[model samples]
Target: MTNTALDQALQTLERATSTPELVKATQALCALNDLEAAKPLVKVLGFNNPAVAAVATQGLIQLGRDTIPILLVSLDARNYGARAWVVKVIAALRDPRGLDLLEHALEADIAPSVRRSATRGLADLELSEDAAHDQLVRCFEGLLKAVRDDEWVVRYAAAYGLEQRLNSAAVSAHLAEQGRAALNQLASDAEGVRVVQLRALKALQRLNAG
Candidate 1:
C-alpha cells in the first residue's frame, strides 16, 4: 500500500469518536502493515477499546521487530489496559529486547492476563546459542516463581512455560530438572484449581513423552 493510505488511516484513527470508527481505522492501519504505522498502533493500545486495541496489536505484531523499540519505550505505567495489550504484542514478537519487560510484567504486573502473557513470552523468547545460557536461566527462574501465582491463569501459563523451556535443546540438564520439578509441584497441588493442575499434568506428560 501507499503512504497515502497509511496517512488516511492514521487520521481516521486519531479522529475517531466511537468504537466502531476506531475499529475501522485500526483495521485499515493494520492492513497497511507499514513501519510508519508502528507508533500509531502503539498509541491505539491506550484507546481503552478492546476491539481497537486488539486490531492495533495485530498491526504492531505484523510490523515485527521494527516495532520493538517503539513498543519498549511505549510502556505506560498507569494504563494497565494498554500495558496488558502491549505485553501481548511483545510476547508475539518474541524479541530478546522484550525479555526484561516480560519478566517485570510476569513478576509484578497487577493484571493476571498481562502476567500470563508475559509467562508465555518469556518461555518463547528466541535466544541465540551464545546468549541462551543466562537468559534461559532467567526465564526458567521467573516461570518457576510464576507457578505459584495467586491467579490460576498465571499458574496455568507458568506450567506451559516450564514445559516449553524444558523442551528447548539449549536448556541445561540441571535447568530442565528444575523446570520439571516445578511442573510436578503444580501438577500435584490438590488445593490448586483443577484446570491449572490439569495443565501442569499435561505439561509433565508432554515432557515425559519427549
Candidate 2:
C-alpha cells in the first residue's frame, strides 16, 4: 500500500486523455496492487475507449480478490461494458458472495457479454463436500440452461463447463450425469453451429476418456 506508485499512477491517469496514455496509467496503477487503484480501475471500466476499458479490466482482475468489493459496487454502474467486465472480474475472484449477482446477470435483458460471462462463472464454481445438494443441483441446472442459450458463445462456454463438471472430483454422481446429458444433447444437436457441435463432441470425448 505504498503511496509512491499509486501517487504517480494517479497523476498520470489524471493527465491522460488519449487511449494509449490512459491504458498505460491504468496498467501502472494495476501493477501497484494498491486498494486505491480499485476505484480508479472501476471508473475506467466505463471509459468510451475500448482499449482503456479492456486494460482497466485486466488490471482490476490482476489486483485479484482485493478488487472484488469495489467491483461489486461498480456492478451497479449504468454502462453495460463496465457491468460485463465486472462480472468477469467477480468470476475470476471465485468468491461465492458474487454468485447471486452473476445469476441475476444471466437474465435475457442483460447484455450478451454479461450473461455469457455469468454462465462461464457459474460453470467454474467449486462446491465443498459439505455443500448442500440443492446448491449443486441449482448450479447444474444453470449450466444446463446456459448450454441451451441462444448465443453460440454462451453454449460454447457451457460445453466447456460440462467437461469441467464431469471431470471435477468434487461434483456428485448425479450432477455429473446431468452434465453428461446436457453435453449429449449438444453433441447430437442437428441445428447447432458446427463449431459448437465440435466443442460438444470434444467434451463428450473427454468425459468418455475419464
Candidate 3:
C-alpha cells in the first residue's frame, strides 16, 4: 500500500472514539500489515474491544517476530486485558524470545486466561537443538507446575503443552519420560475435570503412537 494509505489508516486509528471507528481503522491498519503498524496494533490490545482487538491481534501475528520487541515493551502489568492479549499474540508467534515472558505470565499473572496462554506458548516455543539445557528445564518445570494450577483451564492447557513438549525433538528423553508421567497422572486424575482428563489421555496416546 502507499504511504498515503498507511498514513490515513494511522490517522483513522488515532482519531477512533467508537467501536465501529476502532474496528474500521484497525481493519485498515491490519490490511496494510506494515511494520510501522506494529506499535499502534499493540495499543489496540488494551482498547477493551474484542472485535477491534482481534483485528489487531491478527495484524501483529502477521507481522510476526518483528512485533515481539514492541509487544514486550508494551506489556503493562496493571492492564490485565492488554497483558492477556499480548500473551496470546506471543504464544501464536512462538518466538523463543518470548520464553521468559511466557514463563513469567504462567507463574505470576493473576489472570487464568493469561496463564493458560503462556502455558500453551511454552509448548509452542521454537527452540534450536542447541538451546540451553536450563532453558529446556525451565520450560519443562513451568509446564509441570502448571499441571497443578488451581484453574482447571490452565491445567488443561498445561496438559496440551506438556504433550507438545514431550513430542518435540528438542526435548531430552528424560524430560519426555517425566512429561509422560505427568500426563499419566493427569489422565488418571479421577477428581480432575473430564475434559482435562480426556485431553491428557489423548496426549499420552499420541506420544505412545509416535
Candidate 4:
C-alpha cells in the first residue's frame, strides 16, 4: 500500500522477464498481503500480458490464507492464468478455509486447467472434518463430470483427487462407483493421461485394499 511497496511490486512485475525474478517477486509479494500491497500484483493477473499474469500468480502463492478469499472469488476473471493461479494460490495457502473454495473451483470451473489444478490442490491439502468429508464426498460424486470431461487432464485430476481423499469408508462408499467410472474414463484418454489415471487408480486400489 505504501508508495515504496507499490514501487517494489511494480519493479517486480517489470523484472519478471526471467524465471528467477518471477519466482522471487512472487515470494516477495506473498509477504506483503495488504490488498493495496497486493492489488498491483493482482491487477497483473488481468493484464493482456501473459508474462505479467504468470508472474503475479507465482507471487500470489506467497499470499497466505488471509489472501485466498480474494483470489477464489475472482473465479470469473477472463484470464486463463489468473483463474489457474487462483487455484494454485489457494493450494499454496493450504489452509482449511481454502478447502471449500478449492472444491468449488474443482467442480464449477469452466477451464479444464483450473478445475484440474484445484482438484489436485484440494487433494494435496488433506482437509479433514465431518463437514469437509461431506463436502469432499459431494465433490467426488461430481468428479464423474470431470472424469468424463472432454479434457483428459481434468479426468485424470478428478481421478487423482478421489484416490487421495478416500481415507475413510464414510466417504469411500459414495465414491467407489464414481472412482471406478473415472478410472474407466482415464483408460480411454491419451497415453499421458492414461498413465496418470492408472497411477491414481492404483492409489485408490491401495487405499481400498488397506
Question: What is candidate 3's TM-score against the reference?
Answer: 0.91
Ranking by lDDT: 3, 1, 2, 4
Cα lDDT for residue 3, candidate 1: 76
| Per-candidate clash tally | 0, 0, 0, 2
lDDT measured at residue 120 in model 3 versus the true structure, 0 to 100: 88
lDDT of 4 by residue, 1-210 (tens): 676986786687577766567656655665676565456666656554565566676666655566666765665456766677667767666666776777677667788878888767766674556577766665665565666566767767766766665654556654677676666556544435556667766766776598
* lDDT per residue (tens digit) for residues 131-183 in model 2: 54655576677788888788888888889877876776767877787788888
- The C-alpha stretches of model 3 lying farther than 4 A from their native spots are 1-4
**Residue pairs clashing, model 4:** 26-59, 30-62
Poorest stretch of ten by lDDT in candidate 3: 126-135
Q: After superposition, how far is residue 84 of candidate 1 from its true place, in Å?
A: 0.9
| Candidate with best lDDT | 3
Superposed model 1: Cα runs more than 4 Å off: 1-3
What is residue 202's positional error in candidate 2, in angstroms? 0.6
Candidate 2 residue pairs that clash: none
The Cα RMSD in angstroms, rounded to one decimal, for candidate 1 relative to the true structure is: 1.6
122, model 4: CA deviation in Å? 4.2
